[model samples]
Each structure stands twice: as structure tokens, then as C-alpha cells.
Target: MEERIIIAGFGGQGVMAMGQLLTYSGMVEEKNVSWLPSYGPEMRGGTANCNVTISSDPVGSPVVVEATTAIVLNKPSLDKFETSVVTGGNLLINTSLIDRKSNRDDLNVYYIPANEIAIELGNVRIANMVMLGAYIEITKAISVDSVYKAFEKVFGESKAHLLPINKQALEKGAEAVKSLVNA
Candidate 1:
């Protein structure tokens, strides 16, 4: 299976980190993965986005012209990438920040209140992880266990204290998706 994903938001929103973790998950699973990131010149608060391709076969390039999944954390990103999602693909929106819905009806769109959930979880920074959790649950591009392994290694000894909270954030995201379906 192959998944072309776009994770986008303003800089400092952990957009690149999410892409990296996904790439790490692919690595752990022995899949072919490529990540390409772009951000505005000013860095923080500027536009930031990344394309991540995870596949069972070889990846010819790192570029993503059309994505199978698009995770948009802001309204601007929603506007920019919504149409870029392939037909019959998935679109995951951080509804806490995006007040509007997508224009495409062909895509499976999920509105996740990631920012609100993260705020409630006591760390707003994990909002990205919340979205990641939901995306992983939806696409199964990588398992939560793989993500945990990636997180544990990435956070390592220096930031070990963050592991629990991040784990909570991931599960919270998965639960949020379930709640959405049940609602």
C-alpha cells in the first residue's frame, strides 16, 4: 500500500515534526518513505507544509503533486491543500482552528477538534499529534505502536517526560475520531 500525505499549517505548529514521525514510522515498518518540507522564509508563524510518501514499493521521488491524505491545521492550509487531495482520498481538518468545511464532497473528510482537545489535555502543542492520531486511525498508514516507538526514540532520554503526555494526546485523538463516528 502507498499513502501520499500532506501535513500543513503555519510554521512552529509542528508540521515538520509530524511528517518526520510518519517517515520514522515508515522506516520502522520497513516501508519506502520520503519526506519533503517547505516553509516560508520567516520560519515561525509563516506558511509550513510537508509531503510524506509511505509505500511498500520503491518511491521514485519525494514530491507530492496530489495527496491521498491531507491534514490541514489552519484555514489557509485548508484553502491551499483541499483541492490537492486525490479523488476518493481523505481530508483531516483541525476543526478547532478551521471554522469552515471542505468544498470537495468526494473525499472522506474528518473534522477533528485537535486544538481544543490538546488544550483540554493541558498541552496545546500536542494538537499536531492529535491530528496525527486521527489520521493514523483513519488510514492505517502506520500503527499506533509504530508511532509510539518513533516517539520514544525521538523524544529519547532528554525529553522522556513528554512521552506520557504525547501518548495521551495520540490516544485522545483516536478516541476523538471514534466519538465522531458514534455521534
Candidate 2:
């Protein structure tokens, strides 16, 4: 299987981190993967995006012109990347910050109130994690166990203390996706 994904939002929203986690997870599962990140000059609040490709075969390129999936965390990202999704691709949107919707009918769209869910979970900074969890559930491209291992690898010993909350965010995101799918 080959899946190209783009995750985008403002910097400090964990867009790159999310990409890192997915890449790590794919590595743990022994999948060929690539991650490339881009950000504007303003740093924290600047626009940030990353392209991630996971494949069962060797990956040839890291640049993603048309993605198989898009996890858009803001309205601007939606505006920029919505059209970049290939036909019949997946689009996971963070609805808490975005009031708009994708008008395309060819794609499978999923929406999550990531920010609000993170806030409800007592950590507003984990909005990206929430979105990640939802994407995992919807796509089943990577296993939850692999994601846990990814967390262990990416966050390492220094940030080990944050694992519980991060796992919670992932579970919350998966649950959110399950609800949407069931509906």
C-alpha cells in the first residue's frame, strides 16, 4: 500500500510533530516512508505543512503534489490543500478552528473538533494528536500499537512524561473518528 498524506496548520500546532509520529510509526511497521516539512518565516504562528509518504515498496519521492490523504487543521490549510487531494482520497479536518467545509464529493471527508476535544481533555496543545488519532482510525493505515511505539521513539526519554496525555489524545481522536464513521 502507498499513501501520501499532507498535514497542515500554523506552526506550534504540531503539524511537523504529527508527520514525525506517522513516519516513525511506519518505520516501526517496516514500511518505506518519507517526510518533508515546510514552514513560513514567522515561526510559531506561521503556516506549517508536511508531506508524509508511507509505502509497502521503496519510496521514490518525498514531494507530494497530490496527496492520498490530507489532515487540515485550519481554514487556510483547507483552502490550500483541499484541492491537492487526489480523487477518492481522505480529508480529515479540524472543525474547531475551521468553519468551512470541503465542497468536493469525490473524497471521503472526516471532521473533528480537535481543539475543543483537546481542551475538553484538559490540554489544548494536543489538538493535533486528536486529529492524528482520528486519521488513524479512519484510514487504518497504521496500527495503534505502532503509533504507541512511534511515540516512544519520537518523544524519547526526555519527554516521556507526556506519553499518557498523548496516548489519551490518540484514543480520543480514534473514538471521534469511530463516532463519525458510525454516524
Candidate 3:
């Protein structure tokens, strides 16, 4: 199966990091993966977007003209990619940042308060991880355990001390969504 995911938000929001983590996770799983990110001046305060593809077979292109899922962290991102999502696709919107709802009826839209959740977790910067957790749960593109392992592997050696806090952030994110749905 092939899955194309787009994560878009303002620069410094960890949008690219999320894509990289997904790409690395796919690599660890031995799945074909590609990550294409938009860089340059636009990345400053402007929109930053990344395309991540994961499949059991070789990926043809890293650019996702049409995405199976989109995690939009801002209003512009949601407005920009909302139309390009495939039918029956998933859209995870950072409700704390984006105030509007997607008009599409064929897709599943999840309005998550990522920033709020992150803030409550004691780190507003981890809003991206909050989004990632919601995306993983909704799409099941990768296992949460796999993501945790990947997180540890990626950040463990560099700043091992931050590992626990990061893991807690991820868990808080996943738990936030779980509580929302269960409510």
C-alpha cells in the first residue's frame, strides 16, 4: 500500500522535523520512503511544507501532487492543501491555529488543539509532535511504538536527557486524541 502525507505549517514549527521523523521511521521499517521539503526564503515566517511518501514498493516520486493525508498546522496550510487531498483521505488540522473547518465531505477531518495540548504538556514547541501523534493514530501509517523507538533513536544520542520529556510529549498527544474520541 502507498501512503502520501503532507505536513505544512510555518517555519520553525517543526514541520520539516515531523516529515524527517516519518521518513526515518519508514526506513527503519524497510519500507520505501521519500521526503521532499520546500526550502528557501519562504521557510522563514512563510509557509513550509513537506511531502512524505511511504510504501511497500519503490516510491516513484517524492512530490505529492495529491496527498492521502494532510496535517495542517496553520490557516494558510489548511487552505492551501485542503483541495488536493484525495477522496476519503484524512485531514488533521491544528485547531488552535486554524479557526476554520474544511468544507470537503468525502474526507475525514480531525480538528485537534495541538498547540493547546502541547502547552498543557509544558512545552508549546512540541505542537508538531502533537499533530504527529494524531496523524499516526488516525492513519496508522506507522505504529506508535515504532514512532517512539524512532524518536529515541533519533534524539537519544544527541541529547539523551530530553528523551523522556519528548516521549512524554508524544504520549500526551496520543492520549489527548484518545480522550477526545472517547469523550
Candidate 4:
């Protein structure tokens, strides 16, 4: 199984971190993975995105022009990468920050209130983790357990205290998607 994903958002929104976590999680699962991140010079509030590929076999490239899934964290990112998802692909949109809905009809679109969920979890930074959880539930591309194991590798041991909340964020995200799917 090969999943080519494009995660886009404003800088400082944990776009690259999500990509790295997915790559690391894939590694933990013994899958071939690749992560490529890009950010504008301004960073922080500037645009940022990453391309990730997880597959059973070797990854042929890290650049994803047509993604199997597109996780958009902001309006601009939604506008930019909405069409980048292949027909019948998945589009995970963070609706807490985006006001509009996707125009496409061919894709399996999921609207996740990531920021709202993160806020409910007591921190807005883990909004990305919320979105990541939704992606995992929708695709089953990687296991949440793998993500837990790779957490320290990406965020470092200094931030270990944050794991419980992050885990909650991931679970909340998955639950959110499950409800959406059921509804």
C-alpha cells in the first residue's frame, strides 16, 4: 500500500512536524517512507507544506504532485492543495480555521475542527495532531501506536510531558472522523 500525502498550512502550524511524525511512524512500522518539507522565507506566519510517502516498497520520490490525500490546515492551504488530490482521494480540512467547504465532489472530504478540538484539549498547538489523527483513521495508513512510539524521536524527550495531551488529541481526532463517517 502506497499513500502519497501532501500536508499544507501556515508556518508554525506544525506542518513539517506532522510530516516528520508520519515518516517516523512509518519507519516504526517497518514501511518505506519519505518526507519533504518546504516553507517560505518568512516562516512563522508564512506558508509551509510537506510531501510524505509511505509504502510497503521503496519510495520512488519524495515529491508528491498528485497526492492520495491532502491535509489542509488553513484557508490558503485549502485553496492551494484542494485540487492536488487525485480523484477519489481523501481531503482532510481543518474546518475550525477555514470558513468554506471544498468544491470537489470526487474526493472523500473530511471536515475536522482541529483547532476547536485542540482548544478543548487545553492547547491549540496540538491542532495538527488532531488533524493527523483524522488522517490516520480515515486512511489507516499508519497506526496511532506507531505515532506514540515515534513521538520522542520527533519532539525529543524534553517534551515528553506533552504526550498524554497529544495522544488525547489524536484520539479525539479519530473519534471526530468516526462520527463524521457515521453521520
Predicted model with the maximum TM-score: 4
All candidates: TM-score: 0.94, 0.95, 0.92, 0.96
lDDT of 4 by residue, 108-151 (tens): 99999999999999999999999999999999999999999999
Across 1-183, the per-residue lDDT of candidate 1 in tens digits comes to: 889999999877899998999899889999999999984475457679999999999997788878999999999899999999999999999999899978999998999999999999998999999999898888888998898888767656787778888889999888878765456
TM-score, structure 4 vs. true: 0.96
The runs of at least 3 residues in candidate 2 whose Cα sits more than 4 Å from the true structure, single-residue gaps closed, are 39-44
Q: Which residue runs does candidate 3 get wrong by more than 4 Å?
A: 179-183
Off by over 4 Å in 1: 39-44, 179-183
lDDT of each: 0.89, 0.91, 0.84, 0.94
Tens digits of lDDT, candidate 2, 52-88: 9999999888999889999999998999999999999
Q: Local error of candidate 2 at 34, Å?
A: 0.5
Candidate 4 or 3, higher lDDT:
4
lDDT of 3 by residue, 67-86 (tens): 99999999999989999899
lDDT of 1 at 32: 96
How big is the positional error of residue 10 in model 4, measured in Å on the Cα after superposition?
0.5
For candidate 2, report its TM-score.
0.95
- After aligning candidate 1 to the native by TM-score, how far in Å is the CA of 10 from where it should be? 0.7
Error of 2 at 28 (Å): 0.3
